[model samples]
Target: MQATRTDQPSASPVAPPPPLSLQTRMVLLSYFAYFFYYFCRKHLGVATPAMVNSGISDTTIGWVQTAYGVCYAIGQFLSGALGDRLGPRIALTTGMILSGIASLAFGLFPIVGVLVIALSLNGLFQSTGWSNSCKVVAEWVNPVNRGKVMGFWTTCYIFGSIAANVVAGTILARYGWHHVFLFTGITVAVVGVIQGIFLINRPADRGYAIELEERSSPATDNTRSGFMLMIRQPAVLLLGLAYTGLKYVRYTVFSWSPYYLVSSIGLAEESAAYASNGLEIGGILGLLLGGWVGDRFFPGNRVRLALFALIGMIGAILLYRVTSGTGGLWGNLIGLGAIGLFLYIADAIVSGIAAQDIGGAENTASAAGIINGIGSTAQLFSGIVPIWLKQRWGWDAVFISFIVIAFFSCLAILPVARKGKLTKA
Candidate 1:
């Protein structure tokens, strides 16, 4: 009996770490892909003031943005399912290339109707970036380290936004607003081509052992069942609801902060664009900290950490509203940075970490799509609501409304926080 112990060992051998070279390559490529995707998407906001100066009404711009939001929301659902079916490499490559084309078209014709149509197409293509890119990370990274990994990985957007501001701002100041789109559009298209050539979809494609358990079966292989499976999960629904509020605030800030600085605080367009970078800079730090703390201390739990950050977000928004106009540039910078810090911690956790946890390897992209889709529906309101509020009440009312939204966002996740921790579906 004692001699039959060959199969029973004192301990299990640890799996070797995933190949660092492959992981790093995938991460860097996806990071830059999404990074430039923001360039095409965000330059519109930077150019809005110039557009207004050229005789466009706030209402017209709002409608154009609303069109983009509608298309983007619909595309999130479709692209997510497609990513699952076709694989991330194809989905991501196609999206980035098309988005660049749309952006270039927007710059070529300055008509309001043309702007509406072009940005709508741009929005649809832009929707493809996040869910598929997240899917890529989910496929390549181990679940055990996903929080920390995605934490750092999600910074692509934050830094992307910052870079877009700097680049777009400088271009607007020197060449013209039209050149902003032309330059960014060409760059993202090139990046997409490079990614299509080199990017691998999964570790197994290259003969490495898959790090996460893949829960795929023929029963849940199709789009409808995968969507229903995610929707049925209580955590997914609650996270989606919570993400709606967070995204509304985030997008509103992205779309309007530069305008606010220019119109209200008396800053030049380029200066305002540079100042807006404070938000993303703060976001970079917050995302990194949230990922590290959640992975190291909370382990499988992310909701509780997000709740704390959401509460902090409420206070930060209040501080930003109160100090921004009175405190001058430094005050405005500090306030925006503070809001960014808290908002992104919660944002990264709910949108990235929690979605991955619930979706596991099989349904990661679909789950991201559903959650982000629901959240993106708020973009419809984000485009019009602040303009409506600011027109009717004042900028103070805009801030107050978002404060209420932040509070409700906290409420949405409270039930999940009480239950403690999520496991793979």
Candidate 2:
């Protein structure tokens, strides 16, 4: 009977593991979706010289860019609403497939009218990538870490731009500019199919129920009646205003810097493409630092970091202007890198991090659409503004205008910097 007595060991309670796979997959799919989107968007910058050689005037090319910008801005609202309603999987996959077809068509057709139409369609479809992807990422991530998370996530644009430049430049060297478009198109189409097969629309879609548990909160009261209410929040309005100016300067560089190097600074076309890569290369650092600063120093207050970035951008633009005149190739390269660093710091903070803070998971797509749509509208003027100024007042005026825009953009966010702090999860 004594031998039969036995004791059992006690067991401690165990908590469920975190949904790391959900976030990992969300980040990867969204990253590649936006990454390939740039393939269609950026080829125009590399192909401008070829376009000019084929009889497209600089003004005509500007108009073509404007056409894309106008359509893209409008499409942002539509596609964003659709993404919110239909889910990311459908919106993004459809957009990519169409954008790929459009890119392929852009390469095949050399006629100016036809090319304009193709680029416009490409712009429309490409608009789907950002807002939908934003919605998806917002659902899986918490606001407390959004700055750091989105900071790294936003690098897709920088890396995508760099990759497009290298690939396009290499193809321009070996196979020709048309092949650049062809290669990128095929790549985008392949990525689109992969995303469609693998991308989950949200945490709830895959049995992760955290979002559902939080549905009782006010932020998740995402009915049509509440949509406008959320979008009109002070953070959204102020960030949107600041982003307009920031996006103008960003698009100016993306649209015409290579052409400026070739025409004003006398670099060869391929060299200009390679040099433009420096801007994005420097942006990688800016984005990482911006996220770190926002998370570490400001926490929920992203406007403070954005204000700093805006000031830095003004100085960098002025320095780059001077470098263009006297610093020679290496100097200009360094200057461009600095400008990119500062510019994207502001962009990653305001456009990527702040938008998520204001929108939350439920309203993120709409918020992204509204802000990005308004910001992109500046592209309409960005295409025409610098070109007109360069034609009349010279490159000095063109650079000065960017300084003025940065000054105002900094001012736009000051009130938010003083009054707002983003909420934690």
The top-ranked prediction according to TM-score is 1
Report residue 401 deviation for candidate 1 (angstroms). Answer: 1.3
lDDT of 2 by residue, 239-302 (tens): 7778888888888888888888888888888888888887898899999988888888888587
Worst 10 residues of 2 by lDDT: 207-216
What lDDT is reached at residue 208 by model 1?
72
lDDT of each: 0.85, 0.80
Q: Write the per-residue lDDT of candidate 1 for residues 235-282, one digit (tens) a residue.
A: 888888899889889888888888999999999999899898888888
Q: Candidate 1, residue 363: CA error in Å? A: 0.9
**How do all models score by TM-score?**
0.94, 0.91
Candidate 1: give the clashing pairs.
Answer: none
Query: Each candidate: RMSD to true structure?
Result: 4.9, 6.2
